[model samples]
Target: MSTENYPVVFGTEDILRSLCDSVSRVLSVTTQSQIRYSGMVQRISKTCLKPDIGCFVLFDGGFSGLVVINFSAPAAMELYEQYMLNMGMSKDELTTSHTSDEVSNVMGELMNQSVGDFTAKVARELQTHITQNQPKMMALSKQVILSVDTHLEKPEARRVTFFTGRNNIFYLELAIDRTEFIKLNDFDASEVPDPDALMDQVHGATAARPAPAVSGTSEHDELLNSLGM
Candidate 1:
């Protein structure tokens, strides 16, 4: 089974395409950015082109190893604005912005979808039922991060990267162990981690989770507090 492992599973290019497709289907977007993801597996050796948001791990339930997911600050901003803040974000707003769990929340369901789709695709080839575990979200600064790298105890792993955008730069990525696909659908929603508790943790750690995106930056930013993330 190990020999069948495909490094392309970690291919950011493919995952980015998958994510773009997944998000676009559920949410509308012009997809103007030229996103590019590094080809190498997400590792400390690879330099982050942007800020770090958080890391997520996947489990197959029985024997598969856990795998990690990561994104750069720019990518996170794109996700926050495109998915949550409405697909029209000015470059300045995205660059200067600080990340929060709210940002994570905007992209969480989409992230789950992307990974789940990737898992299903990989599993179909192997004739196995793959599922997603409840995603673990966290907030962190780029300063303390010694390494942008990630690894799993499983014997098998796959990594890849790509650049996407009008200029042909990769913005986002996903890494997976094909053998590690878990049966995430196996459990009911209640069995999953409480999003409320998780969000509380994020607010407690980050610089006050940004209130939900307001109608306009000014009018909305003020109203964000009342939205109750």
Candidate 2:
């Protein structure tokens, strides 16, 4: 399989389109979607994007990660707003606690749909199975999620990112641990189709609308690398 992305077993556009469609279809509300730094997260070498409202990470459970996903600050806020709006609350009166809790709940469901779609595609392709549990909300700073002092185990840490739809930028530290990292190190392009063919489809699959500019490549890569894989 190709290293920049998972090898293209079936249709690349088919998978990504399914993912984007699934993300939009699953969310209960449409709360302004956007992206930041839509490119490679060099740190862990994970495919990442900085959404306007936040950032998030997706991982394979085979990596033995305790926490497989994470999101960013504004992402929390935007989701909190969506929850508030869905509940019929006025945006002006929203407070800190309400926003934090609401973001956690909304993002948790978002993680569910996203992971479900990802795993479903893999399962169908490999003819394997994966089951997902409820994802918990961090509701605190990005550091809080990683700090064992906060009681979130570190061993299971997977790739982290701040996926959002607002604008400024979001970040997540996606750690894959050494074990899974090794599996990826040996990966190549055998499973993927012609790079030109897949890249063509992958690029075409993105949003037609213009988006805000994101951060530098080196910076994004540093974040992904920290994730260990």
Candidate 3:
């Protein structure tokens, strides 16, 4: 008799969960606020970009998919303000309206970061690569629905609800080709790198390095002299 362990199967819902986690992780860290998603996910017939603010990006390669994040006006403003404040911007310097071009740009940037993280995880965990287009953002006063233009023979759509620390709500919609990954062999997934730790390492190395020798009366020497070095 032959003994073998069962292969691990990752299906549609697993992929959706991974994408949701990426969004939560990126936004939470960037804004220095808590971001949580619904425990239940909705199986939708199609994905659409809804009113207030809508951002979308398309990815292709190992799998083709579309990601859409629709934010309510309040939710968009909350996240934008939080992120800006975390970056050391004062409240007076922040925009009050979600429809402002600056608001759209900031939201787009956040979406880009989130999707970039998701793609990296796909490469590491799924052992496949995917490339994403630049995120597109729109502010809409009325309801508007947009779908992916790319072809997905058997598309699966899902929507997950996300909440900001202030309890503002947003929705994430995903449409992807129905697919699965079955692990054939045992392997550990790569650990995600910690940005804070990486920055500390860089600073430590710089501090330990000797200053480069400067010719007579150079700006570097002048600075060092001013510091009584």
Candidate 4:
């Protein structure tokens, strides 16, 4: 078979499961909240992007990826209240008058710690060292689509929601390009002839087309079957 015929297969389910486990652990420890895995969403859409405040942390190693945790304003305020209460602050002292700077600082610290825990989990699963960029807050005013490769399938993404208590819900999103994802998992590339060259060729050929706006596991599975993986 030609070198180009080699199949590429990725286990997105396994990746999302691992991430869900990691987030559950981190949130439970830091926020003293009970977390339950809700469900997974295949695409980044307006419904899922409803949260206005979010913190994003970048992961870099064999592959580049991001871990984003989003919170509604009310949810953010609730989390802040819970955190302060945990720190021995009296409920009487807790007030809504706290400036954005104060709320953002606490949120940023929690996000930083959460990302640290997540990277540690990823390192164990991938058996490779993982480095993360500083976590930062972002406001989503409109819908945003992910970058995809025309030569390959769209990136795999899953959103896992965790219900704490009293209707407090928070979510984490994991999206990774299929090609880089395989690499991050330490897939064997020995059989491929010039893997880097092959990737360059494929990317060059698919450079002109725009990435797909929607994604699903079924679509990715179809692509995998077509590749004979």
Candidate 5:
């Protein structure tokens, strides 16, 4: 008989942290921003309501789910400004505040990268393939109320919040059918590298890098850190 790899089973918490890690990676590479997880909730609570903007990305494969990101007004504005600047727009070009269309577009692109990263991370974690749908952005006057698919037990959903280096807070919600998530579990311990081994690899690589000029290295690092790099 032919054999096939199975998807890894992950708890709601594992999924939330992986998504958060994906967000952090996207922010770091795209916006040069840093983020840390703030909190998580297992259901659609009031806190997940009334977001200024939202982006939804669907996933397929053995691990089917939805990732919905909601940005607060301040968080949206901050990200928009930085994203525009990174796109080479001048401050003068940004004299006016961002409109709904602009915010939606920028956030759509951001979430697209984030969810793409999430899928990659999930694939590595699960040691199985996963597919993602194109991200869809929604501009809303208030939060959306998603209808539950009765055919599938109430989706195992969670709200995960993260704080940016600039102290801005934004959150994303993850929803996967409970049965699907459980079915996907086929965890392989060997797929995950040892933490100590990874740390040694990092240290070894860092040790091989040439020393920076003492006078300017700190200043340069400070500048990048200020930009949340």
Candidate 6:
């Protein structure tokens, strides 16, 4: 059978799914907690930053888009606490309020990692590159509607619900140009590389390498004698 006959189409929802996977994967690993998203997605006209913690990142290159994650106060604190605890920090040393700059910084960092993973997958799976700007995070008291500064032709927006290990709810919003990628031929998408496995391989190779020969007094004497000194 000709492969072209069964062309696979990748569209807006597909891209949103990839971004959601990256979010879940990165957060799950970082905080050692179960992070998941709802299977059903909401089609929205625009993306916004909602209280209590709002974060957004813009990306361009292969495709331009904006990613917004609105975390409730409880959701923000839960993730921040879990991430810090995972890093060996005691609960007493943690901040209790999500309004703290530290909490915003941590959330922003996680958002950055999530988008980074998404972009990497896009490069590997879609065979195209995208560049993301630094994530901007704010502790909002009210909802603020924001749009991407860059013009997106035929823009499409989506919102997905996410839950942390503690069942704290948050929302993820994505706005991108309406685009589709039709597969022309069959190819396997590359898997994400494991950092721990890569480090183990490096250490194993280093251990297997033979040490360089060291010069001793006997060898020095042998050299001197060979020189007729």
Q: What CA RMSD would you report for each candidate? A: 20.1, 23.6, 11.0, 21.7, 17.7, 6.3
Better of 3 and 4 by lDDT: 3
lDDT of 5 by residue, 86-111 (tens): 88988677634434677778878888
Better of 1 and 4 by lDDT: 4
Question: Across residues 112-205, which tens digit of lDDT does each residue of candidate 6 receive?
Answer: 9999999999988988899999999988886465554536888899999999998999999999998877787667788767899999999999
Of the candidates shown, which would achieve the greatest TM-score relative to the real structure?
A: 3
Scored by Cα lDDT, where does model 4 land?
0.64
The parts of candidate 6 lying over 4 Å away from their true place are 1-6, 143-150, 191-229
Instruction: Summing lDDT over every window of 10 consecutive residues in candidate 1, give the lowest-scoring window.
Output: 181-190
| C-alpha TM-score for every candidate | 0.47, 0.45, 0.80, 0.61, 0.66, 0.79
Relative to the unseen true structure, what is the C-alpha lDDT of residue 70 in candidate 5, on a scale of 0 to 100?
Answer: 73
Q: After TM-score superposition, what is the CA distance of residue 172 in candidate 3 from its true location, in Å?
A: 0.4
lDDT of candidates 1 onward, in order: 0.47, 0.47, 0.91, 0.64, 0.70, 0.91
Worst 10 residues of 3 by lDDT: 1-10
lDDT of 1 at 150: 37
Give candidate 3 regions above 4 Å deviation: 1-8, 191-229
Error of 4 at 215 (Å): 76
Total backbone collisions for each predicted model: 33, 44, 0, 0, 3, 0
By lDDT: ranked, best first: 6, 3, 5, 4, 1, 2
Q: How well is each residue in 1-229 modelled by candidate 3, as lDDT tens digits? A: 3223555567899999999999999999999999999999999998777889989999999999999999999999999999999999999998888999999999999999999999999988998899999999988768466665647889999999999999999999999999988787767778777899999999999999999986779888899999999
Candidate 2 Cα RMSD (Å): 23.6
